[model samples]
Target chain A: MNTQAVKVIYKYEMLRAWNTILQSFASPVISTILYFVVFGSAIGSRIESVEGISYGAFIVPGLIMLALLTQSVSNASFGIYFPRFTGTMYETLSAPISFIEIVLGYVGAAATKSFIIGLIILVTAGFFVELKIAHPIWMLSFLILTCISFSLLGFIIGLWAESFEQLQLIPLLVITPLVFLGGSFYTIDMLPPAWQTVSLFNPVVYLVSGFRWSFYEVSDVSVELSLLMVLLFSVICLSIVWWMFKTGYRLKR
Target chain B: MSSIISVSNLSKVYDGGFRALNDISLDIKSGEILALLGPNGAGKTTLISVICGIVNASAGSVTVDGYDIVKDYRITRSMIGLVPQELTLSMFVSVWDTICFSRGLFGKKPNPLYLEQLLKDLSLWDKKDNDILTLSGGMKRRVLIAKALSHEPSILFLDEPTAGVDVELRKDMWVLVEKLRQTGVTIILTTHYIEEAEEIADRVGVINEGELIVVDDKEALKHKLGKRQMMIELEQTIESIPESLWTWSLELSGNGSRLTYTYDSYSEHTGIAELLRAVDKSGLLLKDVNTSQSSLEDIFIGLVKVNNEGSA
Candidate 1:
């Protein structure tokens, strides 16, 4: 209901993103481009196809999802963490704004930044590999939902992390490995039967698989299951955030 | 005058059983400056935080304009603006955007003219487009004051506002504070400097060991608790005080070369004339005489010492 408050917080965050344009936007675009060169040109020459689609085109959705997940988590986490670190959070906490409004402001801005990066990476991916959206609506929905869910997760991490090491811990040791092992660059079908079963446990698999289905109607898991998993993860993150605010965990003392 | 904020029987115990506040009760009258004076760890900041709704009370309650702080947090919070002790700011943010954002966060409509006036009032208009990192420490403190006032809250809490600033800036801050009072905003400031309280506060509250030991009109507190001392230097050194002068409750120092008489200043007759006449009659030759009154600092130290000894 406090749209003005949300707008102010969101604008301030977005301005910070623009201030660090290279780190926020350019770095991801360039990294995705490099991934195309190394994966599409170097490795694609050895393996021409993944399933029926060309290997170069096959990883496009996964790469975008990878970037989306990382950027959403890091951006949102840093957004909240920096405020706390500098003690400027008192300004927002003492304001007349509600917790929901605060969340909407911070999380909304993080998702928008990640969403933009995801779309840009998708376009950059198109330059190296021929791309198609089998279900454009589903692809956009999946992209947006992934951004929101991951940003919420990042918001929780921002609250829970007590130090800089802990902030980077989940993203580096946990999230990156899950994304790479979740079949971002290769299909789980290429893995042996036992390995594929192990890969199914990784949550990033559901996100990438669901997004890939939107792109080429091919995925490691069924489209319905992927959507359900994303929805469930979103619900869980929301509940945790709601509880944090209600209990004044980290945000208040 | 009606009280704008009331805190009753408030107490706060941190997670580790550290009792930061103990049954504090205070009322802040509208449009008056109330200064809370305490030593380090006396719970001055904690008291301000509770009334501002930044910290939750373990027991009891606080109300702003009769609205409960916890149940009606939004309404009560909207009425208060806090200038915290820390210099916390987003360094990359421009001064203009910072104030504007703070105003919007309070759900206020855009008022560029008012904001312009605020900037001008704080002498920050020239630096409006500059990043906060480029500003000096004093300027940053001014920006904080500006941000707190951006929403035009009726109640302002300034915690150690002049802690590290120079005397010139401290004077300017008080001038600005007086200007704000003219607009009918209630101000509550906390300081360890008794002079700061003496300079600006209409009423002074001395808190020691998490308990408000005294709250009274500044002048009245001094008048009631203050002591006057009269020192007389003897023409010759004497080993001990004469038995006749002992009736005056005198203290002999400087190897009996000086005598000090302590008395209540508020009493109609200080009995100083009698003491002098008695000294003369006792053949105590006086070389020089001087009188001095105890300051707020002395009274504060005395009160804290008493409180510590009582609890010990």
Candidate 2:
């Protein structure tokens, strides 16, 4: 994989990114805790078992995916966007650092932040309701893949964006809505056949299914298909990133 | 000596059809400080951007230290460090950390001694642990310079590096540049301020309306295009110019305290002595005589004005 370059960039950017996250740490942590109390304990009584699992247990994977997706986008977008807005990207581009190094640094940072957030939510979810992992390694794999995929997607969006408004457009107007409609809160099986068929089209569904599969040994879709989707998305994102760097797209030109 | 940077037929026509750099070409000698001077939109920044590979050139080829900028970008880029006009740093990072990170960007291993020396040179060693945002504007500018130098490149490009900096700090920067040049680090700088160029440039290149108007040695550029103005403070107020003084194209001050005469430095006869004799014959008392030579700024304006008139 020749990840030596990626690893160094990842380490430096991750350490610095964690420093940045410290600012929003208290807020997201408190907000997620409040979400558990309000939705898991307060609302769980009204809802019956979802696919034979408790409502609290069913929403846990969805909530973790939700947090992972948003944080990945925001962290990656802001990480690259601020430098571009402030004109520091000029310094970066002029340096000897290859384009691959830059992508690794920024995307790695975003992925790491999301991974940590996913873990925190996982541990937090465990406090409210006991979680039984059918395959812990698969769960971690899916989590890492999901984080890296979204982070790379966010990096592209950041580069393509010119202004602060443009940077926020993808995360707010596009990603948030897609995650919500990706069947995070309820099972697709409960929906009418047509709506469930539509829900399957959302790419986020694969991620949620993969994460949920690790927990209950059950999923809306086959685990192999979900993992394949993740790999496909990763390949597509990497190609786009590689093209942006090679052409010196928005960053250089 | 072999040229370090060879720019041939470089042109940058921005998306708006405004030609920022038009067919500009020059050979920058190894280890020389070449100053690019121009008015706003004269393509100084655009030129440097192309050479540093920061901005794409519409048409042209540049070779840095014999490596093609487009094909051998890694080697070319690694050879040059740029201190941009904008002072942008990772505001959250410490001064020392920022410099080290920049060094690592060039694939250079961390040399603690070199890093310490670079920090000490910029007087940033004292503030090494401080976050970038906490520093003053002058200090931030210094940090930018330090970051650019951290990679130990053979060539350095400074785009208005001293803009908004204090006079003392500006001098400090020049001194550092002088030291760097002595160490065989070729320097290229773009500045709207003429005095900065006059102070350090070995050769001066002027661009106007995206065209390279002239490139010459500092002394030669001044001598070739420079003009001198003779200011004759009159003894008393006068209502009109004397007919005999008309040949000199003299301009009389409204208050009659001064008479101005413009002459080419290259001309054999300035007509100054004859004009003085004419003044005496015309019975005008000359209170005082003072002479001033043209500056690079004057020459630059003169050249641009000539180009504009020719185009018109």
Candidate 3:
């Protein structure tokens, strides 16, 4: 398994996050606080509640998921893209480590980073609204799954990206919009029935719905369906990553 | 000595139909220093990259210590350390961190004692804490070497290691290579600097147009194609070659004041005496005579030229 190889890569990646303390750790904390202020105080003062949960409390899971989605993608993508861009990836490629080890190192580190950010956002959420959990285990399960799967997606994006512009393309053009329209800030039931049907197409809906259900036991979709969707998405991302390594796409020539 | 690395019928056709390596077959001995000399854009780097597992060969196979490069990659790759031609280091990572990562990357147990000494040997000990971005180009090159050696592999590939290095540092690198050779580490290097090969290589391989045209012991390669030039200084300039000396095929240079006769130095009969006699008899009074030995560069150029002409 080349565990030491994985460890060193993991530690180095973790160290990089620690080194960029403001960007890695502080950004999510500040964003969580701001999202609370703007969406919680500004908007929540009017809406009061959604689906019987306080507006401030209702958006907490969505906020964490939003940060999780973006951070996981960006962290894993940049973690890999930096090495490829700087040509340092040659060392990793030539090393005795296998593709699995490389993924474990890069993706694992990125997931860990997002996991920490998710935790930070959760803690920040605690200060603003009373936090409650119907299923802490499921909440954690959903969070961990999202981290791993999105990090895998991010790893793919990193490998697939050719330039810095390409790196930003998927996150901005694809993920951000998906997260926004995925019912992170509002319930899809509140939308026109047509828009609600359209929202089902966005994969982020399942992630947000599943995560929100874990917290408040209120979800747009069934818990089992949400879990299956997350698992299904992870499997798809996993298969893509496996194919990338096997075919030597972007990582080898 | 057993071959530490064996590449058989290796061919690489890059994505856009560029042939990087064409049927390269070679065996690197256990502890000998081999220098691959080629012009720019030649397959030297590509070949090294393939054996080191950075690039996948389109056809054929390679084995390091009897393990296939692709099938049993871990075993084969663990046996190799590659310092690529480019400055492939992280700008933000400290020198110490870089080596530590590489050491672990190759699955070597962390040995601070060994790493510390390695940094000291490369004169990078003081800069261990400094980011690679802060170091000079030469220091970065040294860091690359240190990173390659971090795992203590039996085979090391230094792809143009001394490129852009100063003369003094180049000498130091040569000394370091010799010292490494003493430790029984087999070294393969690719360089445009023929003298670097001449100075240290036990064997030299010349690659041209994605083909390994020749690989032989240093002395043997020199003995086979190493031409010697005899410059005969005439007392006065002449308008044309004397018909009597035309049979010798001497080159008239230095405004006809000198004549150059190229001959195989290793041949029992170099024909040097005959050419000189012919020159004297042709009314060219020799003021002085000087002989120059052709360097490996000349042989390399000759090989490439011949290969190019063959392709053309």
Candidate 4:
């Protein structure tokens, strides 16, 4: 429909997210640094090189995905949740803006935050270990795609949440565990063959592997498979979000 | 004026088995103020929400300026402005930013001059740069009004626009409302304060228990349903009412110094003469006579009570 309206919404929503970027910077950056300090310095000593890359550098991409995923989900979820909580959701729903416009605006903002966090973690990891970029464009593409996919997922979570506690549940309980068990600190190859097959089923594995492939040119999974998985997740999440808007689900209720 | 909003057989039944709005229907004319008056849980909010397209109707059709609410939602929503009752503003956003953002939400380009004028009119110009959280409750309420009017919709719905405001701000809001009305903006407001409707509404609609019980011109409804009371100060104290004045339906005060006679104003016969004759026949000299008329509040209470009793 109105592309200009969506752009305007995206611009302002991005600005709103930027306005609060500093508040999140302290915690997320500190967490990333701790990951680097503990995993790169302490854990890397005992764990030798895996897949010909240093343990410190091997975990960088996974850590970045972790940052991207959690920040993307939190920022987008809170972006929609606070508005609904404060009653500004009424203003948005009643606006001439379409559902795509609203989602794009919010997801764009969330993705931006995730990108910023991802960048911060990337820079932080560089201080501890040497980083390589095998395909800079693919890295950026996967970064954006993963951010958007999880942001859409977060947007849906925000709509379904009735209170602040419910809003915090997903990022704390669901995404954190998924990221931890998604081959962030250890490769799936380190697991038993059966566990490796099971880990292949974890969606975060594809995201982390795709990000790792972008950096070191080596991944537990194929880059093409990881890209396809990210694309598929993005499409499915986008469709569900679109359906929620069309049905006016919890957003209107 | 032609009708600007038409709602037919609108109803909303929640999954909890509560009928939030029952078969409600009403037509709002352009360039007029229609006050939806009701107590809490009377479906006033639900009616406004549905018409504004914020809530879906279970079974009904609503057309705003000939655009269906559901089928042509974008156009219909663009034509309507709703000032919700909740104090739900972005606390960190500046006042000017909030209004401009709201205007942008309607796909309107930024008009700094119009925004300046709107802020000035609402006495929010001085606080344009101030974050919304820094403003007092009254000023935040003003910002909410500013945001609602930012889009410049033709029809405005204010849900309890002045529920908990100081007298000065309420007066300012009423003045602003009058100015908006002067610009041919049709306003439909829901309020628990009957005096507000009595003061500004061209027509008043009363809803009770999810159903619209009455809709009439403010003064006309007052005249049609209003009751009158005549209090007479008796010259001498009486232990009880006199049988001679029983036909007058008079009641004696506890102190026996006053007599009150209640009568319907719309009745063809007021029976004041017959009551006076009987009072004289009873040898009770009236020391003083004072008359009082029912207000919109009285009429609303009476209508709601009658409707509830009838339904029960």
Candidate 5:
């Protein structure tokens, strides 16, 4: 329980976030605004309501979730990956810190950065559509949980990736498609029955559906199932990280 | 002095079945500078890595102050600081922040006064606010030293501390290392430069092909293994060795204008007087006589060559 070590690592990571203000903070905000402009104005004109909620407001939670997933993954993965790339990880590995503290520091900082971006996007969504949270506590919990879980996944990716190409491979080729197909802009109910069944298989659906439920009290899946899924994913990521540190995979050799 | 770090039967084999270390054992005394000299890929880094808890040993164990490096990692790690060979640093972080963070990572409470003095000692105080990316290679190396010392560890490992460094910085680093030695910090440094070991090390350990071939006090090793050469220049050339000097193993060179005699310096009877007397009695006109001692470099090359031949 080296709290000082954790704090030091966490603060250094956060400082790095500030140093790259444009990429860490501004990129997600601008992208979220653009989503609103394009989807709210172009798509909202034709589709007036989604499950009795205004079309513009219906996608807010999904958009925020989308930002949360990608930001958390990218931030955390790059946080760990850059250290490995620069060979500076030796410093941390040789320090008097445990693996848990190292994970806590890096994953904690990445999650915080993603959580802040999600909140900023949520506030910016207010400008385009009237927003309300039917269950604010659940919304906050889901946001925090999603940030943490995704950040852990990102940490694993950072450890597993050997090159920059591999680092971006999953986030772009896997996560972005899942987010888009998981109902970021529209509900799965609008899809054909067969496609709707397949959409349920995508893990992002559970995350977006659970997040959307907090906003409008309507979702593609039960909120309880989504919560269970997120917890399960978090546990899986934690186990892998534990095993990685124990075996010194890609870190020690 | 008691041994602060003890390694017993340590071995490391990489995933591909390449044995990087082979049953290496060593005991380092506290407050002495030990230099581990080896060629590239001689497992110098691997040995250091295992002791520092960065690389896991495949066999046996290492203990720092009697605490196991693996089971008691945190405790032992806190006692050691490593200046790695690679100049790895965060480009965006300021020098001050980097050192502070390194210290904190060791779970040490903030000691700004100590850090300030450390910066001053390394001559990095003026560039404390500047980002690491802006600093030159030499300055970055200095920062690495500052970072290693930030935790105030009793044992410090400097892995090639002066590799690729300029002559001036190398001299300054030697001075700083000596100063640190005076402060009672046990320093273990690995180097390919034999002069570095000869200049500052109290003990010298030679590792070749993943095995520690020799470890002895610097002066003792020099005296025991080093051979001296005596060169005698003659005013006139000779066609062959004089019968009077036949007992002495002397070789005529420079087209017979000079004679060289190799002898064990550590031996009580070098027989230099007898050889010179025999040469004078043989009627050889001596123009000049000089003696040269073998350096650590010569001894190292000889040892490595012999070991290679024996293994081959």
Candidate 6:
């Protein structure tokens, strides 16, 4: 399995995270604080609760999901893309490792980084609101699944991206908007019947809804569907990655 | 010295239909230093890139130590190390970390002692902890070499290893190549510098326009195509070639004071004896006589010119 090769790539990426330790852990933590102050303290006072859960507490899972999604995409994409950009990916491609090892190394490190950020944001959100957990196991499970799935997606984007601008395009124009409109800040129940039906098409609605359910047991969609969504997303991303390596697309040209 | 890497009927056609390699076939003997000499865009880099598994071959097969480059790539690639022409490196990574990381990528256990000695060999031991960005161009070049050798592969492909570095590095690199050769590492290098090949290559291959024009032992190539020249000086200036000397096909040069004869020195009858006799009989008194052999560069230019003219 070339486990040593995987370890090398994983550690190399993790070191980059450690090197930029300030930016890696601090940005999301600070962003989480601002969101709590603005949304939890300032805005939640006007709205007492969301479906029997405090308004501040309701947004906590969504906040973590938002950061997890963005962080996973950006970290994984940059990890692979920067090597390609600098033309150093030759070492990786020329190495004895298989594509699976390459993915395991790069995607695993990125997911680990995002997973840590998700935890930090969760802990930060604790000080702002009285957090409740209906299923702690499920919460951790969902967090890990989301991190892996989104990081896989980011790996695909990294291979697909040709420029730095294209690197940011998917995470910004596609991922961020989906996270926002997928019920990160609010409930789908509040929307009109037609818009609520349309929100089902957004895959992230499944992610946020299922994550929120693990916390408060109040979800717009079933938890099984959310787990299925994460699995499905990961499978699709894996297939694309497989085809990329097989065809030598963008990588071996 | 059996074949370690065998490429047969290989071809590479890019997406836009540009043929980078044209049915190129080569067999690199194990533990020998083979140098590929070619002009720009002459498929030397493309050929190395394909064998290194960085570029996909359109057709044909390459076997490394009896393993297919595609099916058994893990095994084949692990045995091969490529130092690309470009300075492909991460600016932020330390030299020590870079070499170790590259070694690990090949699934090799960490050998700090080996890496330390390697860095010392490349004169990079003192700067091992420094970031690549802070090093000079020559130092970075050394780091690239250290990284490629970190895995301790059996075969090393150095594509234009000394393109821009100073003369001192060039000399050091050749010494290193010679040392590596002694350790039984099969080295294949692509270079524009024909003299570099002539200096170090046990075998030399010339590629032009995606074709392997010629490949032979270094000395044999020079002997095969290299022309020998004889400069004959006369005691008296002559207005023209004497009628008697016309049979020798001598060229009048040095403002008619001298005659030059070009011939294949390897031939049984070089006509040197006959030409001198003709010159003596023609009363063009020879003050001095000298002979010079054409270098590998001259032979390379001659081959490429012929290939180009043939294709045109």
Q: TM-score for candidate 3, please give it.
A: 0.97
Candidate 5: stretches off by over 4 Å: none
* Candidate 4 structure quality by residue, lDDT tens digits, A1-253: 7554666667767777668666666678898889888988898878889888999999999888888899888888988888888888888888777888888788887888788888888888888999899999999999999989999999989888999999999889989999998999878988999989899889999999888889988888899999999999999999999898887888765
Model 6, B1-312: lDDT tens digits are 899999999999999999989999999999999999999999999899899889999999999999999999999999998898999999998999999999999999999999999999999999999999999998888898999999999999999999999999999999999999999999999998888998899999999999999999999988888899999988888899988887778888888888899999998999988888888887778999999999999999999999999999
Ranked by TM-score, the better of candidates 5 and 6 is 6
Encode model 6's per-residue lDDT on A1-253: one tens digit a residue: 8988999999999999999998887998898889889999899889878898888999999999999999999999999999999999999989988888999999999999999999999988888899888999999999999999999999999999999999999998999999999999899989999999999999999999999999999998999999998899899999999999989899997
Query: Cα miss at A121, model 4 (Å)?
Result: 3.0
Error of 6 at B4 (Å): 0.3
The weakest ten consecutive residues by lDDT in model 4 chain B span B245-254
**Residues B60-110 of candidate 3: C-alpha lDDT, one tens digit per residue:** 999998889999999988888998898988999899999999999999889
- What C-alpha lDDT, on a 0 to 100 scale, does residue B189 get in candidate 1? 96
lDDT tens digits, residues B1-312, model 4? Answer: 898999899999876789988998899999999999998999999899888778878998999999898889889888888899988898988998889888888877788998899999999999999999999999998998999899889999999999999889888888888999999999999998888898889999999999999999998998888889999898899998988888877888949989999998778999988888888888998899888999999999999999999999
lDDT of 5 by residue, B1-312 (tens): 999999999999999999999999999999999999988999999999999878889998899999999889999999999999999999888999999999999999899999999999999999999999999999999999999999999999999999999999999999999999999999999999999999999999999998999999999998999989999999999999888887878898999999999999878898999998888888898999999999999988998898889889
Give the per-residue lDDT of model 2 (tens digit) for B190-279: 988899999999999988888889999999998888888999888888888899889999998849778899888678888989999999
Give candidate 1 misplaced runs (Cα > 4 Å).
none
Clashes of each: 0, 1, 0, 0, 0, 0
* Model 6 steric clash pairs: none
Which lDDT value does model 1 have at A250? 85
Clashes of 1: 0
Candidate 2 local lDDT, A1-253, one digit each (tens)? 3243345456667766667666435445666778778878899868898878998888888888888898888888877888888888887777666667788788988888888888888888888998989999999999999999999989989898999999999989989988888768876787899989998888898899888989887788999999999999989988998998877788876
TM-score of each: 0.97, 0.90, 0.97, 0.93, 0.98, 0.98
What is the lDDT of every predicted structure here? Answer: 0.91, 0.86, 0.92, 0.88, 0.94, 0.93
What is candidate 1's CAPRI-style docking category based on DockQ? medium
Candidate 3: regions farther than 4 A off? B240-247, B274-284
lDDT of 6 at B256: 83
Q: How accurate locally is residue A87 in candidate 2, as Cα lDDT from 0 to 100?
A: 84
Worst 10 residues of 6 chain B by lDDT: B276-285
| Weakest lDDT window of 10 consecutive positions for candidate 2 chain B | B101-110
